[model samples]
Target: MKKQTRAIASTLIFAMLLGVTACSKKNSNKSKKKFSVATQAETTEAPSETTESTTESTTETTTETTTEATSNPLGLKIDVPQENCEIQFLPEEERFKYDMVLELNEADHTVGGHVVVNFYNNSSEEWNQLCMRDYSSLFKEAHHDGFQEIEVKEGALTEVTNVMNETTSQALTCNRDADVSVLWIPLDQNLKPGEHMTLSYDFKATIPLVADRYGLSDGVYNVTNFYPILAVYEDGKGFSHEAYYNFGECFYSEISNYHVTLTLPEKMKLLSTGVENTPANADGKNTYTIEAPCVRDFVFCASENFKFFEDDYDGIHIRLVYDEAHPCGDTMDACAEASLQAAKDSFAAFNKAFGKYPYPEVDIVLAPIDAGGMEYPNLIICTVDAMYCLTNSYESFPYEQMAIVVAHELGHQWFMGIVGNNSGMEPWLDESFASYTEFVFYEYLGVEDEMELYSRETFDLTKEPWLTSMQANGILPINRSFYDFEDADSYILAAYSYGKIALYQMEEILGREAFHGILREYVHRNAFTNSTSSRFFGVLLECAGQDNADLNKLIEVLFDI
Candidate 1:
C-alpha cells in the first residue's frame, strides 16, 4: 500500500432531458496509523448447551468474545488454518452452477446486494465457513436466506462510503492488516469438500451520480458491486483487503470465469462482461457466458431502448449496445466501429508484442450514465452522451474523441484484464498504463504525429496559470485514502493527462523497441496476478539498465501536485 493524496469531488451539472447529473468523486488521502496481523488456529466448535437459556448465553458469550477481540484498535487477524475450497478458472458452464441475478431499485438507485453463489467446494475437508474481506465501510447486518452476521465490536470495521450512504462495513476481531468476514458460515451443514453450497444475502448499495465502483443515471445501469463477487484469497497477496484505497489503488485479483444471468424489465437491454450465450431477442432476456477465460472480475449494464449492433472482425466478436433513438446515431456507429478497430489493433499489437488475447469476444456498450468510461474484461460500459457531448456544438465535435475513448477501454484488455493489477495500490498500472496503450493505438492508426502535434499546440496555446491551477492536488497515493484536500483535477491528471505524458517520456527514455519490450514482458510476467508499481518500474529498469530512478517520485509528479 502506498501513500495517497486527498481527492476533491466535483459535481457535474448536465442539463439533459433525463434529469441526469453525474458527479465525479476522487479517491485521495493518507493515513499514518493502519495495520493488521495473521493467526492460525483450529476451527472452534459450536458449543453445545443444555437449555434454550444456555443457547442465549452462548450467543452472549460470542458477542462478548467479539467485543474483547476488537477492544484493541490494532488487533485484527488473518488465518488460513486450512483450505476448504479451491476455485479455478474453468469454462463458464463448468465453473458456475447458476446465473447471478441482482435486483436493483430504480427509484433510489440502490442495489439488492444479495449474492447467491452456487459453487462447489472440491476439497476433501468439511467446509464450515466462507471467508470474505470487507471492501466497503458502511455495512449493516443483512437479513437474508442462508446467512448469519457474526457480531464484532462497534467501530471495529472500516466503512467504504465513497458513494453517499452506500458503504460496506467490516468488523474484524483480530488486528489483521486486512479486514475480512465470513460471508457464509459452514459451506453447508452436512457438507463435504466436493459438495456444493448456495449462499445468498440481501444487501443495499448507494448509487452515486458518478460512482467509481458502481452507480446509475437515467435508464443506464452501471452495475459494479451489484453482485457479491468472491474476493481473491491467494498465497502471497493474502485476502486482498485494503479498506482504505484512493484512486491510485484500483483492484487486485485473478480473472475467473463468469456465468451471470441478469434479470431486468422486458423493456430493457443488457450489456455484460462476456459473450452473449443467448440471442439478443431471447424473450427480452439476455444471457451471456464467457467463451474464453477472463483474468479479472466481471461488470455489466442494463437499459431500456438500447439498440444493438455486432461485427465479427477477424474472429473477434464485437457488439455495440446503445440507445437507438439517440441524436448522435451516426457518431455512435462510428464510435462502435472505432472501438472494434481499437480492439483489433490492440490485440494484434499485444499478441505480437507480449501474449495472446485470452478472451474470445468483447462488447462495448454505451451507458446512459455520464461518469465517463469504465473497463471490464471483454466489455466496456461508457456514457454515450458524455462521449458525444464534448463539443459545445454537435457539428464542432470531431469523431476522434470517440476513437480515443474507445481505444482507452480496449487497452484495458491488456493493462487491466490480461495483465492483472492491484488498482487500489497502483492505479497507474491500469489507468496510466491503459492510457499509454491507447496512445500506442493512436500511433498504430498513423495519428501519433497528429496527436502529439495537437498536444504541443495545446500546451503552447493554454495559459500556464490555468494549467497549473488545474493540476490535481487531491491525489492520494495508491492503497491510501482521499483523506485530505479537495482538488478534483488530480484524478484526471494522475490517471490521464500526466500519466500519458510520463509513459510517453518513458518511451523516449527507453527507446521504442526496448519500451515496447518492457511493456510486453511486464504483462507476460504478471499476467493473471496482482502486480505493483515497483514491479513494473523494475521491468523498465531491467530493460533500460537504469537504477536510482525514484519511480515513485515520477508518479507523484504525474499529478503535478
Candidate 2:
C-alpha cells in the first residue's frame, strides 16, 4: 500500500496501510542466547483447538498439491511436511460469526444496523466482560493532516440500543474507555475457555464527509470500521486495545465469519468483503445477502455513480468499480481499464507466488481515497488517481507503479487477510511483506525492470524523521507501534519502505527458491492464525539449516531482536 493525499499533485503513497506468518519447527540456527526466541510473541500463544473451519470460500489448497506439485510452482528444492490445521480449535467450537442487518440512507449519509455476534472463548484467558473497538467513536471531532482538513460533524456513533448477552438472557451494561471507542460489556456469566456466548446490539452512525477509509464523500460511502468489533484478547493481555492513531492501519482483529444483509437505496452499487448471494429489489430498496467466512473484518463501499467493469480469470470473478464522479472521466477511463487489467495480472502473479486466493470473487474499487490503496478480505479500495496523473491528463504515473499498488493491496490478502496480526503493534507484518510481494509480482512476470523500480521505492529511508531519532538511539527497529512514529511519512518509511528492503536482503541471503519455499510453508502452517515475528524467524532459521548467521544478523539489525 502507498500513501497519497486528498489532492493528486502531492501524490506520495507513503500512507500505505502496510500490513505476516511464521512456522513452527526447531530453534533458529542462532543459539538461545543469540536470538530472543523466548520473548517472541507467538512462542506461548495460538488460537483455539485444532478444528476444521466450515469455510464458505472455494479455495482448496492442500499441503500435498501446494508443496509437492510436480510443476514446481514454488521453486523450492526442499522436501516439506504435508500437514494441515496447525492451530488449536475444538471440534464443537464455532468460528467467530457476525450476523448484521444494515440499512444505508444516502440522503442523510447515515446507517442504522443491528449486529448479533456469536463467538467462543478461543484463548486460555477467561472472559468476565467483552472488549470491542468502536472505531466510529474515535472520530468525535475534526482532523488535519497538514495537507487536508477533514471537517467532521456528528460523525460518531450517535445511537446505540439493546446491548445484550443472549446466553443468560441478560441486558448488559456497555462501559466505555476514556475515548469512548473501546467498549467493555459485562458478561452475564464468566466465559471460560471453549465456552460460547451470543451478543446482540443495535447501532447508528452518521458518516462524515471525508475521503478516507471510514467516511462518505462525493456520494460514495466507505463504510469500514463503522461498527463495534471484538478486540483480540491476548492470553495475559486481556483485550488488545491500542489507541486509534491518525496514521497507518492500527486495526487488529480475529478471523471470523460474516453474514450481512444490507439494504441500500436503488441503484447503489455495493462492493463488499464477502461474496453476494443475490439481491431482492422492492419498494425502492435493494436488499443483498452476503456470506464471508474466515475473514478478519467485514466492510463495504457503495457508490451510485460508479462505472463498473468486470472479468473472470481462472474461475475467480474480478470487478472494478470506477467513480464516475471524478472530474476526469475520459482520462480516468484509460486508467480504469489499466487497473482492471492490473487486478487480473496481480491475481495471477500472487496466486503463483503465495497461494490461491480463497474467495471466489475479488473487487477492486477505484475511489477517491486519501491513501493509495487499502485492503479488505475480498475487496481493495484504490485511489482513482492510482493509475493516472490527474494534473497531466493522459500522462500517468508509470504503469508499473500503478500495477504495484494493485499488487501490494492484493498481497494483503495473503498477509493480513489470510494470516492475521495485531497491525497496530506490527504494521510491517502486512505492509512491508505486501511491499515484498510487489517485487514478487514483478519477478514472477519476469519484469526485472519493474522489479528494480519497485525495489528502489523503499530505498533511502534514513531521511525519514523517525530514522534520525532511531539512529540517535543506536537502533533501527522495524517493530514499531502506530503511536511510535513521528508522523505518517515516518511510519510509512519504516513499515512500508525499510521493512520491504529487509525482506529483500533476506531473500538475497536465503536464495529465492528457499525463501519462497519457507513462505509456502509459513502459509501452509499458519493460515488463519495471527502470525508472530519470532515464528517467522524460526521458520527461516530452520530452513536455512543449522548455520545461518546472515539471517540472524539481519533480524537483529532490522527488528533489534
lDDT of 2 by residue, 432-546 (tens): 8987887676555444342343232453333355446546543358877656665555566667766777787677667776676677667756778788777776666665664
Off by over 4 Å in 1: 1-213, 233-238, 243-249, 279-292, 325-331, 334-354, 386-398, 450-486, 546-561
lDDT of 2 at 16: 29
**How many steric clashes between backbone atoms does each model show?**
48, 13
Instruction: State the RMSD for candidate 2.
Output: 10.3
Cα deviation of 95, candidate 2, in Å: 1.6
lDDT of 1 at 189: 49
Report the number of the highest-lDDT candidate.
Answer: 2
Predicted candidate 1 versus true structure: per-residue lDDT over 246-342, tens digit per residue? 2333355545545554445557666666554543446554433323234466666767857777654323456778666555655566655544544
Top TM-score prediction, candidate number = 2
